[model samples]
Target chain A: MLAKSFNIHIDNQDLLDEAFTQASYVNEHKGQNLKFYERLEFLGDAVLQLIVSSYIFQRYPKMPQGRLTRLRAAMVNEKSFSTFARECTFDKYIRLGRGEEKAGARNRDSLLCDIFESFVGAVYLDQGQATVEKFVQQVIFPKLDEGMFAEFFDHKTELQELAQADGPVDIDYELIDEFGPDNDRSFKVNVSIGDKLFGVGIGHSKKAAEQRAAQQALTHFDTEGDNLV
Target chain B: MLAKSFNIHIDNQDLLDEAFTQASYVNEHKGQNLKFYERLEFLGDAVLQLIVSSYIFQRYPKMPQGRLTRLRAAMVNEKSFSTFARECTFDKYIRLGRGEEKAGARNRDSLLCDIFESFVGAVYLDQGQATVEKFVQQVIFPKLDEGMFAEFFDHKTELQELAQADGPVDIDYELIDEFGPDNDRSFKVNVSIGDKLFGVGIGHSKKAAEQRAAQQALTHFDTEGDNLV
Candidate 1:
């Protein structure tokens, strides 16, 4: 089934199985001392980074490092990887614990992302870089050519650039409030441009909150006027 | 000269020169708009990640993903890369502006690290993966085999593990104080185990301060005996 899906020969069934296995599944079968996809996932994450970075580096030679970094960041993230995984129907094959399956973790973005990376790692181990590269090329390059990841620009950076485009202006992210238990805390951030409050956002972390705030600020600038000028 | 040092034939001297050219140097010669190494560094960093991760993944199959992650983080950061850069005499070849040259930026860890990665990127562009892999294998594998990066375990994680080795215990890092200008500030952190203060550390950033605090905490535990039990 895996061989047919990727259109590549995977000789090692054990590696493939390991790639699909999650920690929860392994924990459920602890006596067997089974391995999971995590190690492979780590390897595959690096593999993906190289493949993606190399592709963007070569494809966009004139693109600045900052932009390349942003592009790569946009591409090789949980959201994008999971989306790719779903496209290849990886969720259908993911081996989850009974509890996880009941909780619908098979379709979870984080899990799908891990499964995709682990699968890539498995392919690299089984077939080698040439085959894996070719596979990634086929899977990822088309979406990239269509400018799928262009939307994932860093909001904070975009805001900063916009603020500085006319002239330097003070932009600040202020943590206005935090709530919830210590373990499940959330942060509320208010982003201000000079004297005016442009946007406010809430997230699980300050960075996330700030990003959301910046995103809102960008949206504000999109519809509203640029008050900085 | 670079070809001689790496013992690989690099046909494109322009790419090689671009790898060594710093932005400062390019800025000094405005009309030329000569490309610098940042873009290549970005690409080379990814290349190095794949190469190093692949090597370590294959080498220690039983090593957990967490350990692999830590090890890779240790190996790929400024200290290790800068050391490797010096080994290749990269500092001698790095082109710098007069101001940077006088400021001794050529010998700086961050610059050296950037140059090394850019050099790898240049080689990847000129010679491709196999050649770059061979070069990195020669330069990096021996150091890795010697466990050069083993010392760089995340201090906070170490402290937490040590604190919990016998049973669950509270480990907390408190920001005791912060000082200096807004743009250039320092953080002071105190690490506490249970109710007792174990370490105090200072750094340019909160994370760094926390790491230092943890490092000191680990040292205290190592010398004064773990008080958790």
Candidate 2:
């Protein structure tokens, strides 16, 4: 299915087989000399990162490093990879132990992500990087053109840009409170423009809280009759 | 200097200049129409990751994904990159603001690391990935051959392997205490084999503390003549 979908060939059946083999299956079928996908996934992740980075680097020559980092992060995470895996219908092909299958590990996001990466790895191993690059271009670049991943840029950056679009404006994120135990700490933050408090948010990390606060501030700008961009 | 040292020619002098231009330099040299290296560094980082990952993946086919990750982490970080930057004498060529140069940003590790990445970016832009691969092979692979990065692997893996070399001893890391505020918390942990406590460690994070504990345990085995590998 992947071969037909991507229009790529894999001469090494072993690599393809290893790409879909889960550790559970190997654990259950010990002494059978079966390999798992983790090693391939490891290699594939770097391959995917390089291909995606190259694509965006060429596509958005003027984009800053920070936004590029954020955009790439948006595309390459477990959620996006798992979605791609499902599109390839890899869940049907993964070899899992009976226990893991019963536990629904076949459709699990991390498992799907690993499968997608391993598939890429297998393709790269069989046909090298150029083939893999074409594969990624076919599978991922269209979605990029559609702006499918643009929403993943955090609200903090959006708010900062919106606040400064008209002119120079002072935006501040202040940590208001921190609480909870060391292992499970929480932070509260408030976003302000000049002297007016715009939004308050609470989260597990300071960055998260600040982002949430920024999101609320953006919401305020969108809903209110403010002239802010 | 870079082209002569790497034996490669860059047709585009602007890209080469941009590779060495610091943000501070650009800030100070406003209206001169200058560019900085951050964007290129972003792309170069991904390129370097893929090349290094491919090299290590092929070099250590039997290595588990976890060990491969650790090994890659050992190589592709600020410390190692800065060391490589020094080997190339990047300090002699980096363009910095007057204040930054006076503050010794030329020799700083973070700056050096950025310079190294940007240099890779410049080479990739000029000569392409094959040239960059050869450049990295020339610059970084010899260090790998010399096991220059071997020491950077976390002690936890070493302790685990040494503990299990003789038998299937149950090794464990237990967090004893966590203290300090949310932003600056510290953890204390101890590693034990079976029922015997091997060592204790303290660090900013649990993983760090566990690694330190493992380091102490390795030292114990080394100094106490424990007949462990």
Candidate 3:
């Protein structure tokens, strides 16, 4: 099944099984003596980092360290890994405990991210660095090339750069509203350029909301008026 | 110099030179068209992570993900990397700007750490993964085997386990003082077990200070009394 999905021959089936198995499942079924994916995740995390870092390092030779770091962070962060997991159909293969399965653990971003790393780890151990690097290049590099990273767009920085063109206009993101429970709270933010409220956005985090608001503001500037001049 | 120090035959001396060259040096000597080590540092950081993660994963099969993560962080953190750099005498080989050299940039932990990562990156690029892994195994695994990682020892966890053995006891770390500039601040912390002050420690950050205090407390417990019972 793993070979069919990933298009790589599995030399060791147990490593693949361990990659799919969650700690929750291992704890519940103590007699089975199954190893979880945590160790694999640790190993995979490093593999992913190296592959992504090398790709970016080669692709963008003139880019500064700070920018390279930011880009790499965006590519390998939890959200990005979760996206990769979904693309690879990891949710279908993931082994969760009865309670976790009932609670929709398969859809959880963190769990999905961990599973993706574990899969990489399994690949590294079973096949070796060359195979893992090829796999990551095929899987991840396209996403990076397509500008899936938030840092690639960087709406806030764009807005700031635009504002600076018009002699330092004061731009601010105000949290206009916040609601929902602690675990899943949403924030509504308004991006104001000087006195004008240009755009509003909603997100789970204040930073996300602010970025969205800034993006919206930039769009408004693009479509409606030459606000910067 | 690197070949003599690391005892590895250098296939590309230029790559080794690039690893030691600081950005400040590049800026100072504009016509030389020399590249800095930042890109290599970025690559090396990932390589280091993979190597360390593999080592720990194989060494400790039963350790939990959280503990493993903590242990990896301790081993690969700025302080640890800086220590490695010092051990390798990277300070003597590092290329700095005249101004930075005058300012003693060679002794800077951040610079040392960056240089160390760059060196690893250089090795990876020059000789490939097998050679780099052998180099890292020779240099780094010995430190891990010696329990150089504080998270491996885990003073806080040890203290908690010890306290549990003697019935329920409240352990707390209080920040007694914070001084110096924001960039180079020192934090003084006191660790108390029950109502008695067990140890006091000072460090650059609160967490470091707390860890030191806990370590000191554990040392006192080891020498003074059978605190476990």
Candidate 4:
């Protein structure tokens, strides 16, 4: 299914093989066999942050740190990554054992999304940020808005640069609470520096929630007409 | 006051003036003004982890991640850092603004703690990890037990490494509310990560309350706060 969706011919069987192999599977396959996507995942994770940082920066030239951070959450979130896996046919390419395959591992969004990270890493080192951005636009940005991206890149980094000359400051975060049931709790967060509390945001989950808080912080800074308390 | 703390035999007033100047500060200011401590603080944040990791790796060959993490936290925490700063008289040499100086910034436990980070950074760069560990022992570990240091370094960095890895995980944190009279209300927090629920912690204030929650989360992951959940 994934093969037909992307229509990219699989010229390299080894890359696909590595992507599907779990650490357990690799161990059984042989001590002599290939290195898998774990390393790729690490590289991809770093690459993911860089690309997202770049995208948010360009999109939100004036947004504050907190807001931009919130928007970044909207962009580079896990749930969205899972959705992208289905769209890209990344699900089909993932390799799993008989037990996992029988359990619908290939159809599993989480598994497929992790592989996308490996793929992103591969794409990043292969072509650098420009091409990575293109890959992201084609694969990931369909559901994301430029506005959200702009908001998330909120000048936190900018604030950071500006604030450093003044003095050393700490980024203080306080997690307020989670609401609703176990699976569907919303999180509230507040971010502060010095005596200033700049952002407050809520998310369906904790990371998302923190991102929301970061986003709020950014927006607060950009609209610095009223001094944040 | 800071100058009064240290008695140095100066050959000439001109020499002292030159040493205080930024250009000449490099030549005779000892470790002062050569390179500010911030960069090292940045690197030390990670390098401290690497040191602790290796320390744990050798000490208890059979220990798992959780215990090691808790141990690390106890070692590097505010209380420990405060003591380290006191032992080294770290505040006496710090450069601060007139206001910060007048406000008794040197006596503030937190500021003293930050200086230890700067000192660690300085040591790490000047002599490397080996020297830094030695410095940690010589300066900070006198009152602390060997078992504590061993425990602290073992699992010390895991939680921070993990919670920070994918961002904050979804925590089902319930702010049960402010009980007692409005004048003396206490906040209660029960934070859960997945099926694991932390024991409730209380605070007299809301910000303090939330910090208690974060601290609960910290303890749940063991002191170093690895990604067990």
For candidate 1, what is the DockQ-based docking class?
A: medium
Q: B2-65, model 3: which lDDT tens digit per residue?
A: 5676677778888888999998898898888788898789889988888888877777766556
lDDT of 2 by residue, A34-104 (tens): 99999899999999998999888878776678667877898999999999899888889999999999999
Q: Would you list the rank order by lDDT, best first?
A: 2, 1, 3, 4
DockQ of each: 0.63, 0.60, 0.59, 0.02
Tens-place lDDT per residue, model 1, A1-229, is: 6567668888988998899998889879978867789989999999999989998777776667876787788888998899999998888888879999999999899999999999999999889888888888878888865767545455787889767778999999999999999999999999999989989989999999998899788876532222211
Question: Tens digit of lDDT per residue, candidate 4, span B22-106?
Answer: 2222434465524333333434444454454445434543343345445556666677777767876665666555666677876
Point out the higher-scoring one by lDDT: 2 or 3: 2
| Candidate 3 lDDT over residue span A62-119, tens digit each | 6567667877887888998999899888899989899999999999999999999999
Candidate 3 DockQ, CA atoms:
0.59
Better of 1 and 2 by TM-score: 2
In order, the B-chain TM-scores come to 0.68, 0.70, 0.68, 0.47
Q: Model 1 TM-score? A: 0.70
- Candidate 4 regions exceeding 4 Å error are A1-16, A146-229, B1-229
lDDT (Cα) of model 4? 0.55
Question: Which CAPRI category fits model 4?
Answer: incorrect
Which structure among the candidates has the greatest TM-score? 2
**Candidate 4, residue A145: how far the Cα is off, in Å:** 2.5
Model 4 is docked with a DockQ of 0.02
* Model 2: lDDT of residue A118: 94
Candidate 3, clashing residue pairs?
Answer: none
